[model samples]
Target chain A: MSARPAAIATLLDLPKPYLLFLGDTREPGYAKTAFGLRDWAPELCIGEFALTEDTVSTGLKRLSPAAAYAQGARAVVIGVANYGGVILPSWLDSLVEALASGLDIISGMHSPLSSVPALREAADRHGRRLIDVRKPPASIPVATGARRTGRRLLTVGTDCALGKKYTALSLTREFAARGVDAEFRATGQTGILIAGRGIPMDAVVADFEAGAAELLSPDAAADHWDIIEGQGSLFHPAFAAVSLGLLHGSQPDIVVVCHQPGRTTMSGLPDYPVPSLEDTIDMTLRLGRRTNPSIRCAGISLNTAHLDEAERRQAFDIAERSLGLPAADPMRPGAALDALVDSCLRAN
Target chain B: MSARPAAIATLLDLPKPYLLFLGDTREPGYAKTAFGLRDWAPELCIGEFALTEDTVSTGLKRLSPAAAYAQGARAVVIGVANYGGVILPSWLDSLVEALASGLDIISGMHSPLSSVPALREAADRHGRRLIDVRKPPASIPVATGARRTGRRLLTVGTDCALGKKYTALSLTREFAARGVDAEFRATGQTGILIAGRGIPMDAVVADFEAGAAELLSPDAAADHWDIIEGQGSLFHPAFAAVSLGLLHGSQPDIVVVCHQPGRTTMSGLPDYPVPSLEDTIDMTLRLGRRTNPSIRCAGISLNTAHLDEAERRQAFDIAERSLGLPAADPMRPGAALDALVDSCLRAN
Candidate 1:
């Protein structure tokens, strides 16, 4: 056979580069890549260049639907910006034309390309792989205080600032203390375009019941069990919807509700921190049972710093009675938390 | 008071009418702008018709430069074809020029302006705010799953795959079950660049630990915890490293370690899902302790699909004897899981 068909020939006979990189200087991710270049793929041949009308046009010129096949670069991953907020057609056409030229194209957009019709069209095309980088939080190991795979935190929040970072940090530290590793996955943000992505609604509900089982189950790391929190509650409908949807899919080990008892005027919720203990527990319990009747809840991690000594105590006790867990706050000494968690494990 | 200085903007300021509405388009955000039609602060505005070929003739244009703001609009938000990658200068410059007349500009890039010197220089000279959306997963909320959010998954191994939509979907489901509304923050195909921004050497290891924490943590929605994976153990080190670093900054609660025991390999440890008994508890304790040492662990979720009945039972027995908790494979019957978890919780 005289080398078979070109596409077939290349498919059968080709030694592609183990590494090649293309990035744009238009975003933070561009430099972010530079930080860990040696780690992502040390051996791959990488190329970093500015993307301009000239550069993009030039990059496209450099590729050939057929030639790329010959030279052996089968994939092209295009990174786009998110804060910019919208995807423009003219901007995408330049890349899409080249994508048509035969390379396996992976388009990475930081936001949902709901506004960009060109993007949607190109994505609809065959042989084109469109990946929204904004679909999930990149998961990895980290430590709040100690070390070991301590805690796996699903970072959630009402708006961008409910001390999501703080809560995640506190929990990680707690888990680390017990010699467990923690992985943080940021789930929701205020700006739906930037932080939130729609996942199936049905799947989210299932994870709730799973959460209870996880808490009651034995942990492989330390002697006790665990906890998980979504970013929002029913109070914050959009994110709560997403959080709920996710539960349906994950079937989490157990579910825990974290929120300041007070309310906040912004984002259309009660004050960020509820002033009353009874309200907090009532809300937590009410929200906890939405997914599964079997789903058990780990007591709240009273964000005590936000409240005074009395309010904190009241909140702790209230949450304890409502959720059937021990009184615990992250910032305080761990003995109580340990005891509370231990008892819960034992009692279950 | 020179109009109190136009609250300069970028593409985000573009009027809804200029946008050629297509298949499914809605600026839920734009609809909610507090500023009236003169809604044009001029700082942020994105428009292709506004920026001509002349904008690209020069090097880079300042979309919302303090010195040169948009002509008519006082404020605007920059837009970029910043899908998963960065934007071209031709496009960026055009966006920059959209803002003129001395309005406070916000430099929006696919990554961070700091990623490249040119963008930084523009931001510095123009007194524009540089927002790094890539490093910090954007906090935008949008319902785009099903028809809203599309699916594209490529498993380049574990670390890379963790950034996939499926993982986010699982997280969303987990949260939903808890009735803690959560949304998917689609960072979309986070490459080594944004994903590995500040990772340390032990990133890969962190991811593995994270997996375990998710499984073991009693809290179904592991939003409180951060990372559960061990360092230096992920399929992609950058993902592990950056994930941990990001979480370190964000600070999560606890971590769960998902252990896979097999042949001795990468970390000089046996595979977690191995056939032997000690493989379960021994590997978990080591992994958990190494990742973090503060937070508590829930339990382990066994990947029993890889093991035969006897092997699974032996593994389960080992876990029970060693860790004193229930075991589960994400694939087990619900009753089996509930009964096991119930017993484990009651076993105090």
Candidate 2:
């Protein structure tokens, strides 16, 4: 628990007033980091930048690195995650230009920004920093399984990139709005950038996954809530271990099962189908009980962005009826989101 | 599957005919590496060396580094896993002495053999290799969960360091003796050291645990059996994620449940009690079915070293009667071990 503050402090030391770089990604799904910062931490994001005219925008005013630097942007955050998480060769020029413009480079890519020779050299010559958010902190201890004093709510998914982070961020805001002591605990890169601190769950060594999770949400006041953003689904073939380790380490008193209704297959893994919401809740509780025996499902959070207004309501109704839990799209704040938040904060 | 040969080739390139270094450890448990090599690959071992006069011995003839090198030992293997897997400062002189004696150093510790300045400088000066078995291979893919050609058996545990590796090794040997095309798949450092190749499961990135497991036991002939070593307990708060990922990735047709009969708590976490054999088998099969729908428990392998002969027999009888699974201590090499191996090989 003592390690939590130090880790958080180090993670939060990233240069602020960022100019989000969307690269050439046309799909909004690829620009999750930019969108996340815009939606969650708009004050910290000065503007958006991109190489191509056809690229999707975060709706912020577009600015060049030099322009953004003049406008108080301290860094250029790589806001798009592409396949393989590699930095494209085509994007190197813009990155080096940013370094030369007196703005630091920040990236959440699988490959480090410093790994690109041009970016590293320009940063070195310009005395700018290249921060890779995916690199986990050194010296995480193994999970102790000793119960912490706080209440935790974890957002688990039925697949990857389907709103686990959104649900967590929404819930933390809702809880805080209601006067509960709540903090958003990030576990992935996008969420880390938005929250200003977190352990990159997937980047850590397998042995320390749970330990890192434990460190992320250390003991707090009994009434405080740590809304932990989850990574991967329990049924996801490739990433379930990350999900399970996070679940066990967080030892959440309440869990919000997040799912995308129209997702036929697990993300990036077409061979495996997405698990049913019922099965997800059942399995999460069963496995999560290994650490927190009294763990219970608080509600269901749906990524109903694909559905029409009528269809969203219908889906929510069906989920609430079948699962006997409040269901809502946290992205669409309303009575449904309120009900879901209320369900989470309710005493067992 | 393409990565398996290359990984194995790289891992098996370590120098052989080793002198086992037991350091100053008095506990036999800490000397597991020395004993594992002695038990599994006796011919590869030249002799054992220890710093203290009254330290527990592997019963191999005591020899100094120079003397073992004279007898054709090419390397000095650090054969003890201490509290932190560290190359202790007190043992630095001996490690440097080994390098000066013209033997390469192989270590399976958490801390790399090359991390110690003296060891690194001495190895460099002597032009000898310093191999660290705990470091995982680079470029592991995310797991696909696609069924492969080979039949596989994985030995899972109720706790860490309770004989999962030994059980898998024993079963492989028995299967080989019976003319089955079986290979021991190592997942931990000691197992890697014994089998000459393995993915250090705990040392891998959390996201790649399952992928590494998949790589470890790749598609083989339909008749081939890859007896995969397991890591950690599914009920273990700290490491269940590793166990789960390995279980899902291994996708074993048959599973052997490994346990220590008299153990009350988890290996290091005393707050949690050991899971029951029935619970371990049930949970393993249930979650393992995600990747492997037809996964089934084969039998039980017990670490009965602490129990007397009478207690061991009674415990085996009770477990078999209660769970309807064959139970045996694989280290004992008798009728019970035969029964357990037979159960594992039987058609599921």
Measured by DockQ, the strongest candidate is 2
Chain B TM-score, structure 2: 0.86
TM-score of each: 0.29, 0.88
A77-155 per-residue lDDT for model 2 (tens digits): 9899877778888888888899889998888877777777888788889999988888888878888999998899999
| lDDT to native, each model | 0.34, 0.87
Candidate 2, position A92, lDDT: 84
What are the clashing pairs of model 2? none
What does fnat come to for each candidate?
0.00, 0.66
Give me the displacement of residue A313 in model 2, in angstroms.
3.5
lDDT of 1 by residue, A1-348 (tens): 221123310001112221122333444454332223223223231232233533322122243334544555554434333344434444565556545654444333434543456655765684554444333322211111111222222333333234443444455456656665543232322111111122212112111212222221213464333333354332232233333233322233344445555644325433332224344334333333332223344445555677888887797777677656666665676665675445323322
